[model samples]
Target: MVTPRLRHPVRRIGDRDIDFSRRLAVMAIVNRTPDSFYDRGATFALEAAVASGRAAFEAGADVVDVGGVKFAPGPPVPVAEEIDRVVPVVRALAPFGPVSVDTFQPEVARAAIDAGAAVINDTTGVHDPRIADVVADSDATLVVAHSLAAPRTQLPLPHYDDVVAEVRDFLEHRVAVAREHGVPAERIIVDPGHDLNKNTRHSLELTRRLGEFADIGLPMLVALSNKDFIGEALGRDRDQRLHGSLAAAVFCATQGARMVRVHNVRETVDALRMVEAILGWREPAYLLHNMRSEGNE
Candidate 1:
C-alpha cells in the first residue's frame, strides 16, 4: 500500500542519505537518563554516554538515538538539564553518522539540531506545533511516533478497537500536519510507538499488523527492542528479551519497516543483514565461506 512518493531506494535524513531499498537500518538507543527502563542509568554520565554512542557506531548501528529523559513518569528534568544531557553526546556522535535526539520540546529539538543532531525522534507525535515548526525550519528529519499520552506519563487504561487501524490513522494525520507545516515527505518518518501508552496486547497486535503501516506512505521506524510486550509474550525479563526483540525486529523488516531502533546493536545488525540476504536484497558478505570445488580438495 505504499505510494510512489514513499517507495524510494534512499532517504535523505540530514546531510546523509541512506539506502533503504534492500536493507534495514539499525538505530541504536543511547540513553542518558538515569531512570531509563533498560540500562537503568548505566550511560547517564556524559563520558559514558559518549562512549556508548561510539561503541554502538562501531558495532554497526546505522543511527544513534540519544535520549535525555526516561519515558516512565520520572521527576521533571529542567529543559536546561535535558539539553546538557543530550547535546554533548549528540555532538560527539554526529561525525560518525546521523544522530537523532529523542525529545518533544521545541527548544530542546532546536538545541539538539544546533548541536549537530540530524533528526528529531518525537515520540509524542509532535503534540506541540512549535516542534513541527522547528523541524520545518531546519534540515533535520522528523520521526513522528504515535503515542496517546504525553511522554513519561502512565496512561490510565489503554484500549483500541483496532490498534493498527487507529495507529495508521494517527500517523496519517501527523504526517499530514508535518507536510502542511513545510516539512517535506522525504524528511518524515513514522513509528507506531510500541508500548508507548499501550498495553501488551496492543503492542502485539501492532507488531503482527505492521504491514498495514505502509498505507502511510513514509519510511517506518519500529522500536520493539526488549519492550514490555516482548517480555510478556514470552514470559521473559528485560535482559532476557533479546531473542524476542530480534524476532519482532525481523518481522517488522520483513513487513517493510525501514528502520528498527534497538539496544543490542551487533545482534540486530546481524539479524537484519540475514533477512536482507534471504530476501536477495543483499549478497552474502562472501560466498566462499564453506563452498566446495573440484579443484579445492
Candidate 2:
C-alpha cells in the first residue's frame, strides 16, 4: 500500500506567519481572452470578467487567476497588446481579492503588478531575466511553471529521458533564479505545467510522481483541470471532462498538492472537501452543526 505523504505548509498572499495547510486551496481561472482554449469568448468584457471573478469567489475559490492571452498552441500576441488586454481586468479585481496575472512577458508582469496584481503566474518558468527583475521589484508572489517549448511553437512530441527528474531539475533551477533575483523563498510557488508540452502518458507520470516535487521546499500548484490528458484518459470531450477533472483534483490533494487551478470551482471544491474528510481533517464548524442530530434519544 502507498503510504500517506506528510503535508507541508505554504504562506498565503499577505500573511507571512499564516500558512495554508490540510485544506487544498482552489484558484479559479478567469480567461479574459477571446480565444482561451477552454473558456473561449466567455469573458470578453472587463465587467463580465470582474463579475466572473466575484462569482468564482462565491463558489469557494481562494484566488482568481486572470489571463488575457491564450497560450493554446498558437503564436503569442505582441507584448503591448497582451498588456492592454490584461491590465484593466487586473485593476478591476485587485480590490475584491488576491489577483494573479498569467503571462510570460516582463512588461506585462510589470504592468499587472502596477495595476494591483498580487501574484505573477508565469508559464515561461522565469527564463527571461527581466521577469525576475519585475517580480523582485514588486512585492508579489511568483508561480514558476515548467514548460518545455514556447507557447507559439507546436508542442514538440513529448520527449523525456525521465519526465519527473527533468521537471524537478527545471524547477530547482527556477527556484535558484528566483532567489538570485532577491525574491523571498516563501513568495515562490511551483507548477508542473500539465499539458504545456506533455502528452497523456507524460502528464499521468507527473501526477503520479507529484510528491517528488515537495522535496523542493515550496508549495506545488497542479493545473490539471479539463486538460487534454483528462479527456484522453476518460475518453470525453472538453465539455464532458468535469468528472475526470474533479478526480484529478482529489488525486492531487492526496499526493500533497497545496493548490489547484481549475475552471469548475464549485465541483472541485466539493470534491476536495470529501477528500479532506477522508484524510480526517476537520470540516468547518457550520458543516458540523448541519450534521447534528435533530432528535436524540
Candidate 3:
C-alpha cells in the first residue's frame, strides 16, 4: 500500500539533510509583516519575529519560514524594507535550525541566503526566474508554489476547470523553469499554493485530489493552516479553524505531502507525529498502551 517517495529526495539545506522520502517536515510560518492574513502582526517587530522563530524551532518545527511581506495585497514594501524585515530574523534563526525566507524577489532571496537562509520559499512559483538563479548559485533549496497572479495583485474570480491538473501543470512548468535557470532537480520542492489564488471550492477540490500530484515527482508542500477554504467549508472563522486545518493537513500528509507549512506549530507537529506513527513510519515514544505491564483495559 505504500508508494514511492519523491524521485529525487534527500536534499541538503544548510548543514542538514532533508529526507523527504519518508519523514514529513513541519515548516512554521513567522511573518514579519504587520497585516498578514493570519497572526496579523503578532511577529511584525524584528525582536518579535526572532522570538517567534525561536519558539517554533523549540516546539519541533523543522523549518522556520520568515516572510517580510504579506502574501495578500497591501501597500508595497520596498526591497530594502523587505530585506530589513526578514534578513535579521533569518540571521538569528539560521544558527539553530533550517530557515526559509518567503519572497519572490531575487534581491531578497540573495540577501536571505547571505543571512543563512537555507530555503527560498518563493510563493510566486518562480514567476521570476531571476530568483531561481539566486537559489541555484548557492546550495539552497527552493519552494516553487502556484499563485495565479503576483502577490497583492488579485485575480478577480479566479477560476480553474480542473484545479489539481492546472496546479500540477503550473508546478511542472515552474520546476522546469527552475532547472533551466540552474536550480537542480534535487533542490526543488513543489507546492499546490492551496488558497493563495484559489477559492474555497477550488482549494477543497485540490485538497481532495492532491495525491494525484505525486506524478509530478517532487516532494510536495502544502500550506493549509487556517486558510479561508477551511473557514468557508466549515463556516468557521480563522481562529476557529484549527480542527479543520489539521484535518486538511493530515489528509494531504496521507496523500504523501512531504512538508506542511502552518501557523500552529505545536498542534501541527503533534498531528503529523501521530500520522507518522499510525503509518508505521515512526515508532511511538515508548509504547505502553496495550502492554500488560501498563495495565491495558
Best by lDDT: 3
**How well does each candidate superpose onto the true structure, as a TM-score?**
0.95, 0.91, 0.96
Candidate 2: residue 34 lDDT (0-100): 85
lDDT of 3 by residue, 1-297 (tens): 224357787878777787777688999999999888999898999889999999999999999999998888767789999999999999899999999999999999999999999999999899889999999999899999999797668788998988888998899999999999999988998999988888989988988888788767788889999999999999998899999989988989888788999999999999999988887888989956566654545
Q: Candidate 2's residue-wise lDDT over 55-124, tens digit each?
A: 8888988778988877666766889988888899888877777888898888999999999888899887
How do all the candidates rank in terms of TM-score, highest first?
3, 1, 2
lDDT per residue for candidate 1 within 1-297, as digits (tens), equals 222235455887656678776668999999999889999999999999999999999999889999998777766789999999999999898998889999988899999999999999999998886888999998999999999887667787988889999998988998899888888887888999999989999998888878777656778999999999999999999999999999999888877788999999999999998988887878878877568887996
lDDT of 2: 0.82
TM-score of 1: 0.95
Regions of candidate 1 where Cα sits further than 4 Å from its true position: 1-9, 289-292
The parts of candidate 2 lying over 4 Å away from their true place are 1-10, 14-18, 284-297
The stretch of ten residues in a row with the least summed lDDT in candidate 3 is 287-296
The CA lDDT at 184 in model 3 is 91
Candidate 2, RMSD to the unseen true structure: 2.7
